[model samples]
Target: MIFPEGGGRESHRKEEIKQYYRSFLWSLVFTVPVFLIAMIFMYIPGIKHALDTKLVNMLSIGAILRWVLSTPVQFIVGRRFYTGSYKALRHGSANMDVLIALGTNAAYFYSVYSVLRAASSTDFESTDFFETSSMLISFILLGKYLEVLAKGKTSDAIAKLMNLTPGTAILLTLDDEGNVISEEEIDSRLIQRNDVIKIVPGAKAASDGFVIWGQSHVNESMITGEARPVAKRKGDTVIGGTVNENGVLHIKATRVGSESALSQIVRLVESAQMAKAPVQKFADRISKYFVPLVIILSISTWLAWFLAGKFHGYPDSWIPKSMDSFQLALQFGISVMVIACPCALGLATPTAVMVGTGVGASQGILIKGGQALESAHKVNCLVFDKTGTLTIGKPVVVNTRLLKNMVLRDFYELIAAAEVNSEHPLAKAIVEYAKKFREDEENPMWPEAQDFQSITGHGVKAIVRNKEVIVGNKSLMLEHNIPISIDAEEMLAETEGMAQTGILVSIDREVTGVLAISDPLKPGAHEVISILKSMKVRSIMVTGDNSGTANSIAKEVGIETVIAEAKPEQKAEKVKELQAAGYIVAMVGDGINDSPALVAADVGMAIGAGTDIAIEAADIVLMKSNLEDVITAIDLSRKTFSRIRLNYIWALGYNLLGIPIAGGVLFPGTGFRLPPWIAGAAMAASSVSVVVCSLLLKNYRRPKMLEHLDIGGIKIE
Candidate 1:
């Protein structure tokens, strides 16, 4: 899943940096003498006297010394460029290596010819450019050394995550009666499923497990991004890599190794770095043609310069000292080829994405990859599911009313029996409320229902004590031919108006009672909607609740668009409708019922506390399940893409101005020419600059406005 279109080449980057450093050392050792002999040493009176001595018919001692020192640098230290060029050409393409090989070889082989021709002829005083080729390779290697060093830094977040796991765990041996027999320290990686482990104070959890024998506060800020430590009692699951703070706890391991949350977070961040962004196609297409086009341009520059010089198109003073038309033309050609870079363009996308995704992971937002990050920035509309997304999701019985003559305890007992087998939040709410009527509060026994049937978006039906009990909304009561009386209708209306769901109980096909349950809006829900509006993103609430209750909650949250009583399939269809209208839509939800909508939206975001299916279907997961993270995800993506755009501009701008200058485009007017070695250094610098620009995203933080809210001109920090 690692989309490597722009920059995510995470393979042996450290090794490559080491190799570049090694090659640079070799290049420096040989190239320094060539430069010294040609430039500085030859200018000295004593050195000039010895270097000017004729070694052959016309070749001087300086020429021979420079050639011998530069030969190893050209053929040994620069050999990698040759191999890379051959591989690129064999594959019917070209790259930075091809340009480096061509430019340096042109200078070196021509110098060899000049030296041989001077040795054979007494009158021929040849100017050999042995220093140009050797110096070019040295400077380029230095640039690569710095570039690889920066590339290695972009994945530091993942490295930190991997380091969170503790090395060892205290595994406990339990007897048949669940009493601890013995405890021994073992490697954390050796822990298996169903093993009991003891975590002392301040120790990190070795595996994902529920507390079995103790209570303590566990700090889960690594996963949830919350600073507060959560209280963990028996049956509360603790994530691996989280520190147990106050008390010792015995835990039964549920997930081990890579199945643990910390490992999965690392894998997801790695995958995000690997995936390619949509805009990377622009750089990719340009790169495919960039090298060959530069080669052709190099040949044209040489031809133009040679033709101009041969026909007296320019003044004689235009040529540098000891260089004629052909040699002058050769220098311009080498400069053009050396200065044109493809590496900068290739790195413009992936590096920024790596840093951006890593930053998101640290803040409890798990963006799938470049595609999701790209989509998030452009989202103009967002659909929110009400129950678990904007509301607390945990419902409680706030009120209970009786329609017929029935003992309240007997009535709750029957309702609790029918709901005991169901896993819905509302069902659990009723069962918990009914527990007060039993003498054994902790372990209450309920009457068994003969046949229990649970209906989606409505309620449950069961046969309890020879009575046909139906518990659900008004639609379910009518579907079973049960009529709602005036008093029941008034109560249902009053409950819905209060933003509470009304569940009716029908005993033996007659209406008996109504249970009013309410799930309060999540904290900062209203502020989140207002912030989205200020960001120019429309927020809509979609729920399966009745219009009255849905509208009441939506009004409180400052949402204008509400779609109530929507089935699972209908939610997805609504997302399609928004997309059809040319809007980029994002769906935020937290249940298995929200999976379809999550998959259908342009960017699907799921609450981390939701069902597994919802998380799997989502493109982004809000690990904290907080409303503020939605804004953080969008703002982060926008900032990351802005950095990417800046990279592209820097890379492309460098080439557009560099190629012409190196090719002698300004020589006719200014009488100034760029050297081939300087051109090679500029090419290397361009790539390093692009990578450094991407690395700057590592310092990114969520917006200050998000951290401190201003609602109604009052600051809420």
Candidate 2:
């Protein structure tokens, strides 16, 4: 029933269309009987003989009855075409509505004229005239009804999206004794930030927030398109409209009402559905000249035939046939107008986009709109943020080197004491490593450390076990006048070559040991790079990490190009540089610092785990933070565009082939002329074909990737 195609809503739409058809049928039932009764009275022997055998003399009863019955039917069924024609005339454009309005009105006025003429002629009959008026009106009404039904079906996607958001929110309040009180509320405005909201299993989340207490598994497939339910725990954020599978969570609401994720998604889908694609613009241009051309052609057809008749010297006796020829020309012109509805042309692109977006949503990818989806298909270069995009973004100690014959426990204890007070991410990594090693029974904690001071761009220094302990890079050791041995220098060089950071540990003016820390590459990172390579898309990595670490991770992920040690703004500049090189770039990242870069790229895709600022800055948001969705998004866009192109071709081709035939272009050569009913049927078939083609998208499947590919070429571990 829905214009474009999909299954679930089809039944409901068919029923609605049936209801409209039933109403139209009842209207026909009432009007057709009256029309027949009026015809009988005007044409019967008794009535005809009483009126001096003249049909026109019986007009007082038949014409009045016909006008009374047809007036309301015309208003009910013909008003849409009338108003549409008026608008088209106002704008100096012609469309299908103009044809319906002209055809139906001509038939009605012709019937009135015939009735008047019949009253003055002794042998005339009203039967021939009344039937034409009734038939034309019925045909036009049927076409209008079909048009309404098709339009309703095509726009159902937006309605389905709007139905996802909940109508009410649960407000949590505190009583005098500080005990919580929950109330089911209808107003979203009553919900505020930091309020504990209880969402039951199988119910949609009222707002976007983080879980404060309890645990549950939420089905975010509505937003992410992942069929599996994601396990939620404390500190994890939950999106609105996602179903809660089990358990109850007291969520501290972070976003409410229109600010919720569900509201934003609904707004995006609605706007995307309303936006037109490139092909529709062509149809609009064609429509602008359609009416004027038809009028000129119809007039010329009448004049050409009349001129030929005069040239043959038979015009005096053939004048009535010339009028009939003009009427036939007018009928053909009207048919052309009525049969060339632009609804299919206009809907071609939007319907494909809507279906593509819905498919992407079901797969955990969120493309902002048709524009973003379209642009993604054209992306030739894909730039990625290194830390969170390729690497795990969490540093771990990968190697340890002893410089002064210090025991492993003693080295770790001293370093842990020195780094425990530091707030840097790398410092925390070292502290955590030391904590795990110190937990062993053989390793004991050192005495309390004091006077901790962190050196910017270097490392930290502190008094551990009553000794001045330094834990930093070689620069920090030299700054404190601590000597580095030849062995320590060799270790640093080897670690640096492997894309690892070396934290130099020195105590009492002597080098002790070094800790090599590096972030591990994410699983399947290399495969994603190879896939891009096969697709002919260039892959590059930008990172704030040192060049050594950047090159190391880049090599591991099969990335040949790397931009190292870039600040947030510098990352955006890199995107601009890529654009200047004439490559359409798609930036992918999941960090706050990547927001500017994301905005600078032609298409920005943010991973779901990314900060809100970064997600907001990007054009597309990937809910699973999986690289596979990037490829899936591009494929979906390409397939959607291809489908639209196919549908547009089919719709335009049908009109192109049928219109000339309908206009009698082939009559002289092949003796073929398209009847009005045949033209109408063909036009309907074209619309239906476009809808069916769009619906076929439901069967489209994502491409499958081969498993168990080796990554040794990139050296990823």
Candidate 3:
């Protein structure tokens, strides 16, 4: 049930592997005898005497025996190639199948004609090529078997993710009083939204939810790449497929089925594998005309060598001791056709992309596929959001100064009750700080606030117990015509100078107090900026806070460019301006109100803890919510493209050198000629080498500078 949106079955996969094995087995069973009959017996004197004896006129027994064994291999065991070639040619495009089918068919039909002509003549000596056609098909099938096996390893990460879901879970049916009425064991897939599930020690949580009862340490290393166990308590969200270490806990399902994080990851990896990079077009353009060009070159090679031999252009000894000038020319033509492979060129980019994306997923970096990887490698600048992105995102009340003669506890009660309705980080910080004054810590009830309002980029407004209370920045107070005292202005100035957001509390159009809230910089914030500078990337900070507070925070983090007091839409404008300046910009944000900016950048990287819209718009998701992952995403892309370049070099270089030698280009002077079967084997090996070269990316580790970095409060080993 944890299977992705598009369902698949193991039965179908098993059948496909079986089909490949069967084809290879059948080719081997028929091809071995044909090779032995045409090659081995010719060297044995007794068998050579019997092979030389003609059956019907000039036709020998060895030729008839090879013809019977090779016929089935040519027609039956190698039928897939003929079908592939037909499909390719019908679409007006040539592929690897066309070259393979053309080479094997020429050798098979020509040997058949040679046998028929020899039977009709008086003293005709014909060299039948049954071994050549049959062995070529056999070697190609063996190569395919190896290629499929190697390709399966590319999806090992997805398979591991799917297998992490547990089979069953303990379901609990609760009453209106929050008491468990019934408990039963059920399949994990049957869990629905809002359904409470019990997780015991040594069991994985059924789905993503928050715990309503009990506490335990859950190990989430498999999903988020955090190497430690996280403590989960009441009202704390827990992810699916994580192990529960101790203590019995009950979690209500918030997201189930494909909507869970595990399923989303699987879908992302699958999409990445399907999306093609712009660099792949280079190989695609070459493969379209590769076969037809090779066919024309092969025909021209045959005619050149045949006319040379007819007019005695080279020494006669250059021909093999077993055959005449005609056979030498035919050998060169068939070798040329088989050696040039289009498969190698076609596999160069895709295989490397697949391995690179898979390696990224294993390290908790989810890339959106080839297009993202292509853009990320060239990113020279990163735009960072201030609050949640650059800092810990959790603001706390640091200092409070009252301008009016009001009780501190009574003022805070009014402030917390008004700010409780707002979702801004600063509002939440005020509410949390106010909770310290209440004696009822577990469930403190505050006075009801009427007509609550949140002003974007400013603050909030509400009415508490007939008292009109306003909590916001100086702009909100001035906009409402609330006069600010000189003492209040001084307090606000001091708060901004200290890198803290200053909140003005006004009651009945009079400035009452000033509350300074400070959000600490995240661990390694300066180091992140320093490492990005070393990588030749510029760092900029953008925020909705005032210039004084934003500049103070930016200076502490070593950021030279700072944009402050901007609305959500204005953030997107800055991204567009930077992009227009010829910089490949990447926007890193918490996916909150800055979604427009995330969509505008060349590459948008969203933190996993961000809003759903931000994750949807981003090209890469930092699942661990760590700033260091931005560096990992960029470095991974540069390395993957480098590997892709190496693959292309090897694939093209093999074809350039192989095709010429197979055409007997070195034979006339050095008497060194490549046989047709050996050329066929080399062609198959070239394609396999390209795939194997890409598979090496699985061993990729993050850059040395990014190693041993802490993520989500866990010190990874």
C-alpha lDDT of residue 637 in model 1 = 93
Tally clashes: model 3: 0
| CA RMSD per model (angstroms) | 3.3, 7.6, 2.5
Candidate 3 lDDT tens digits, 420-439: 98878889999999988886
lDDT of 1 by residue, 2-71 (tens): 1222123444676688899999999999899889999898789999989989988999999999899999
Clashing pairs in 1: 2-274, 2-275, 3-274, 3-275, 3-276, 7-350
lDDT-superior candidate, 1 or 3: 1
Residue 695 lDDT (model 1):
89
Question: What TM-score does prediction 3 earn?
Answer: 0.94
Candidate 2: segments with Cα more than 4 A from true spot: 1-54, 57-73, 91-96, 106-115, 118-190, 199-204, 294-323, 392-517, 669-672, 706-717
Better of 1 and 2 by lDDT: 1
Error (Å) of candidate 3 at residue 156 is 0.6
TM-score of each: 0.93, 0.74, 0.94
Each candidate's lDDT (Cα)? 0.89, 0.70, 0.87
